[model samples]
Target: MVTDRRSEFEATLTRTAEARGQEAGAALQRASLLRDAIHRFIRNRAAVVAAVAFVVMVGFVILTPWLSHGSAYGVDFAQAYKSPSWAHPFGTDEFGRDLLVRTALGGRVSIAIGFAATIAIMIVGILYGAISGFAGGRIDDMLMRFLDALYGLPYLPFAIITLAIFGTVNFWTMVVALTIASWFTTARVMRGQIITLKENDYVRAANALGARWYRVLFRHLLPNTLGVILIFVFLELPGVVLGEAFLSFIGLGISPPKASWGTLAQDGYSAYEAHPYIIIIPSLAIAWLILSAFFVADGLRDALDPRTRET
Candidate 1:
């Protein structure tokens, strides 16, 4: 009797603990849903601020050329290397072209290149990561080996070789270079996330319900991972911009006649003794753009992390 009573007591205790755990889990889920909703609803007031700044910056870069009466390329010996004045704000370069116009054009190229490269990286990363993670086993092993092989190679050397063979840094080439060099990092992060997500109860339940593989992967897995993906994308932009600028700085980027922040900076630095405005203006623009992206990204990192609010 004593033994039977002891076993019954133990079982009752176990059931009581499990019941409390379920309740706690439900409470936690409700709290998490509430927090996520609040974060979305507010939309990071800081990001809203950044959205405004980004809009103004984009407008200035894209619209100023159309708005101005004179062309960016129009040269006047009289205005060559002139100081910033009421008539010619941002001054003129060595060729007497409008510094304002060149800088604006440069901004357009830098931002555009960054956007293109980042998109390509994200697409490749998402597909590669999701597929490998879901398939797992030998397929995952083979795919990861390929990824590791690429990662093992020296990146800068590879970039230099690829650019040298291509012999141009036009729009497509720039996109290719950035995409090739950058996607691995995204792929690794995404693979880890997929591994964690694929094991979730909902994903298993979907599989058990006879849902098709593609539908389950896309409808259930992708949507759930979007928040994480978005955060990474924003974080990646600054790195992309910096890479474009560095490539341009080294003369391996968007070639002359087309301006990029790096090319502009290169020109400015070379002529610094004679033309201070050229370097100073473009450099400042690059600084501002980078800073704006970084600040917004930082705010997002803080707000999006689930543990942040809990702590």
Candidate 2:
């Protein structure tokens, strides 16, 4: 009886050791993958430059207003349309507001809206898609049909309607307007990924082990889809920025006295002929940000793709 008990104890010990070994191996593998992805991203020179430029631009926008100790709303007609000089590098706008300060402030608003809306989009899309895909029956069909219906709605017009319903067009309102229709694409992509991933052996094993639905979804499914999520975030940012800019340009976004890149461009539109730099500076800022975002997204795509990972 003692011998039998010892034998059982040994078997338990062996199983425990094997489990630890497997867990350690998985941890190492994950670390190696992350390291390789970073290396790949660093090797892409344009992406590296773009990432740096984006960080610099963000810092500039955030700090410029604070360091200048100036209000974006401050206007002085006497200094109106002053040419770029020692006092104001970007010159003055039609209202005689400092273009540099206003441009920086505008960037803050635009970038903030983009990020806030993108986060909201990701949260809604991920949860909806994950649940739908995992359920995989009438529920999936219903959810997908609803998403399809949303897809038919025109993006800008829908946003306009959303803003109208809120009876205001401000930061949070813009985020909601952008998030409403924009999440459809993300949901579709995530749903497709979840469907494919749910059939994997590990996922099946997780289910067989009686893990909770939320645990399986968050730990096993969503973790595996990180690559897709990261790529989508960078790709979506530029669209959100542009959308906010477009709405603001049309007088439905951030109101006057509050600056946004779109509003700055709108403010400068009529004066472009006599003072072309007013429009040119803000437009250039928008173009640079979009280009940088795209390059970073491309780099992340290549880095995270197993097929493209360097051996």
Tens-digit lDDT string for candidate 2 (88-166): 8889987788888999999999999999999999999988988899889999999999998888999999999999999
Per-residue lDDT, model 1, residue 286, is 77
Query: Which residue pairs in candidate 1 collide?
Result: none
The estimated TM-scores of all candidates read: 0.83, 0.91
The candidate scoring highest on TM-score is 2
Candidate 2, residue 258: CA error in Å? 1.1
Provide the RMSD of all predictions against the true structure, rounded to 1 decimal. Answer: 7.5, 3.0
Quickly count the clashes in candidate 2. 0
Locate the minimum summed-lDDT window of 10 residues in model 2: 18-27
lDDT of 1 at 39: 75
For candidate 1, which ten residues in a row score worst on lDDT?
Answer: 18-27
* Quality of model 1 by C-alpha lDDT: 0.78
User: Mind giving the per-residue lDDT tens digits that candidate 1 earns over 109-178?
Assistant: 9989888988999999998988888888999999999999999877656766677778876888887888
What's model 2's overall lDDT?
0.87
